[model samples]
Target: MDLNVTLVLIGVDIPRSGLLRSGYPDPRTGQWVFSPAKTAKSFNPSAVTQTERRFDLVDLAPFDYDSAEGMTAFVQHLAGIEGRLRLLRARPGMLTEGEMPEYLFRRTHGIVGLLKRLIEDGCTEAMESGAEELTPELLSTIQINLGNLDDRDPTAGEIPEVPHNVPVPARKARKKDRNSVFDDRGGSVAGG
Candidate 1:
């Protein structure tokens, strides 16, 4: 007979390293879904259930933006935030967590720009902290999507090598003198 002991929570809030997971809206539907990284790692032990219902965080795969759009749209969104978090927190039925991604996503997708802003902010913090080495800790954690080709799957080889079509503006091969039809200079030319 399997005796089911009531699960007890003894401790909480144990911080550990983990991937800053990402999620995005479906192209067909606007619903938010986990990115490949998150979806892939969801099966891992760190994500499934902690020992005695506790988690030891881990980063299996790094989080990032969509396949086609890249991080540009994400950065644009972050940069667009005008420091009015109240509006963002108030949306999606006043649930900040559920709505934050959408709130961010609605504006833009420039991840690299957002990261640059974060680094700039961290630099400000570094300035205020008397140039302490520990100050960079905050800056170190930031994961910026710089749209690097390293993000691609190595097994896939090159990305099909898109042939760029450069349009060359055609210049007039010959310059012709202007002739006015009403000048009547060619009126007798038909006699030939």
Candidate 2:
């Protein structure tokens, strides 16, 4: 019998040690050791071989928080989806009206997870308080934690304040210097 298999490992910050190491094989066993702590006594024979290809994932760019269009669309989409806003009362143009978008962006800092939590909590609050619409006043009362600390303490690290009416500044263009090695005798090359 013959079998084929493919192993896939995914993570945000995968350590170079342990099974991921591409070190020299042990002289006695001729096997790669997977000890991350570098202790002589600790040895794991299940280390990954150097033949395996490693691909690093590029970090995703943050969402555009300066503009409310993206946040507004996300909220609208979330509400329109089935099983999402079933309990909340139907209100025409409820999410996209007035200061709701700005308020939401300010609270969530354009983070999708935070925004979702805020919306879900706001919906629950609306149902309980008989206020079907999501208002700035209603959302302000709903305290959102950073989710890094313990949930038991409601007064833990709150979401960082995002200033209103302040747009994200544009990134400055990087200046490129002419390669001195390839430069001509006429001072320096005009372009690369």
Candidate 3:
């Protein structure tokens, strides 16, 4: 629920060319003027597909940047993965109404796991790196600080299983055949 540190972030630029908009004809000039479009809201009801995507080392807290090449490579690699994930998630109607809750669960679960691993990795890396470069007093401080972090639980704890009272169909209704139209299975859809 509360995170003090931001491990990794991705920025995406949705090009204007990709946006879907509506237009209204002006009564006086007979010219079409742009208006807000419910493109995403109207389009999501008939889609069916769910996927789980994995991004390795999402926030590598314990990553050692001993050398410039290692740091640069790590940054570039993480950036690429983050960028791809952001784009995948940013698309409209990617998560159907039924899938929204599950998507949120997966995303939050993934982030918590990432944070846990990062802390563990950071502790190990810090100890090793500290042994090599840190002074006795500095090492003591590092040990005290990171040692306290070891006991903390990184999981999103105590999630009670709530039954879905609504009767959910085994399969979501699709507007078109899966083969006819592309599904959101780790790839971009045609109009989406």
Model 2 misplacement above 4 A: 1-61, 67-83, 146-192
lDDT of 2: 0.54
After best superposition, candidate 1 residue 22: deviation in angstroms?
22
The global Cα lDDT (0 to 1) of model 3 is 0.34
**Cα TM-score per model:** 0.19, 0.44, 0.17
- Alpha-carbon local distance difference test for all models: 0.36, 0.54, 0.34
Clashing pairs in 3: none
Give one digit per residue, the lDDT tens place, for model 3 in 1-192: 445655554311111222313334466765445444334554563221111011111222233345666545544543443344322123333222344323222322323333233334434554555532212222123211224445434442223122223232244567874573655567775797
Worst 10 residues of 1 by lDDT: 10-19
lDDT score, residue 60, model 2?
31
lDDT of 2 by residue, 1-33 (tens): 324655565432223334354444466765444
RMSD of model 3, in Å? 27.6
